[model samples]
Target: MPLWWHLMKSVPSLQIVLHRIAWSAVIVGAFLFWRDGRGWLKRALSKPNTWWMLALSGVLIGFNWGLYIWAVNAGHVVESSLGYFINPLLNVLLGVVFLRERLGRVQWMSVAIATLGVAWLTFRFGQLPWIALALAASFALYGLIRKLAAVDSIDGLGVEGAYLFLPVVAMLVWSETHGQGGFFDGYGVAMSVMLVVSGALTALPLVGFAYAVRRVPLSIIGLLQYVAPTMQFLIGVFVFHEAFDRDRAVGFAFIWIALAIFAIDGALRARRANARAPLVPAASPR
Candidate 1:
């Protein structure tokens, strides 16, 4: 993702997002066609609720992608990392408010700690961490809608791409006509190729994630998600050499502690659940 951000440095962030959507739509749409043909799509489109939910999710994800790309290219990768770090906590809050889900005492404590961390960052920065908050909220909402939509992951993504396709095409055409387009604008062969490949870059990981979620335990998946933001944090601090002062460190430390608490709680729950399940006996005749 960082590499893609770097490669797309010269292109407008919106354009990068548009191309990603356009390319991803083609790839995911193809995969959906191959996997389930038109049947899955027909069923999905037959429901008005599905269309509404997907349209909302599509917009949220588009905002997320555009903002994230802009943040990375604008040298705010650390802030972007913070956004993802806050995402799970935001999900918890959203569930409470929108889904009427109750939080256990430990979960409440974790949320409180995370809230403090966000507050501290806001205080030190003299402004709300809008980038972080926006990213977290948008993605949490997207996830909620997808959950409610209850469609196959690949098929849902195809629907999202379909919603985004026309706007992107219009944007690209406008850019080209106005002589502001990056593609074929003398950026050379490698970049043009990268621009085209961005579609695969965007879609393949999502397909992999969708596949893994079905097989992996939710606890493990939840814990593993931190890996991406952690890498982004490292890249921002060490590779990109973004500014990191003591105050920000203290704030991030609070969030880390909260995450640790959340993760341990989830692990314990998973272990208990596993222990309570009935064991199957081996077949002697085999």
Candidate 2:
């Protein structure tokens, strides 16, 4: 229940995600350039194995983003919001299934509670939370593959972008030539900004995430990584005007309770270890 302190406040969700992706692309791509420049470019271009794995991860991430943006924009904010709430649990599941990570009793209980919350939400809503599940599963599998491949985050992303960008470029050019395309024109400054910066923004948190993964234990980062999704959820409820029905309220309450238990368990475990880490607060604005 770490207090979701307002952080990184920005534009609308669509713009935020879009701009973040763009910024990450430029920043990370430049980092790759400085780190190895032409040699890195050559290596990335020449390495089919690298691109092969990266291609799959890229597609998964792209699909996740597209679905997520569409969900938010198409008045499915609740579903998109649910996806983020489910993400941490999905990550834990991935760790358990793929990395053979062990779960503590409390952790297992947390997962169980979370699962029940999802099921209850689904039953009450009378439909599977497909968007949430898709977002969670896609992102979880993407992380698993990235870790398993052990590829350089930025460079690997550049390769992924190259793979995606080529076909996109062709389509863009073709449409424009045939007078059917509006990219880079319809949105004026917005399109210009996105065209140049989308890749960099998409790439930054990843670089931070990569650096964080190496510097901190997986367990620690996993806990910290909750910040982003929690932020996304708030945006959904407050900024996006998503209604909270009784079922949503109940489901979210259960999820919050599970988070509380998980947080307490983590705190207790940390205390037993005599760790000096600052305790995360338990209050998040509703």
Best by TM-score: 1
List the candidate 1 regions with Cα displacement exceeding 4 Å: 281-286
Residue 64 in model 2: lDDT: 82
TM-score of 2: 0.76
Where's the lowest-lDDT run of ten residues in candidate 2?
1-10
Candidate 2 lDDT tens digits, 1-286: 0011112122233333444344444566678889887676667556446657778887888778767765666666666667776777778788998899998988889889988888898899898888889998998888787777666766677766656665555655676577654445654665545544545545666777767778886557657766766776677677767787787888877777777788778767777776766678999999
TM-score of each: 0.96, 0.76
lDDT of 1: 0.90
Measured with C-alpha atoms, the lDDT of residue 119 in candidate 1 is 95
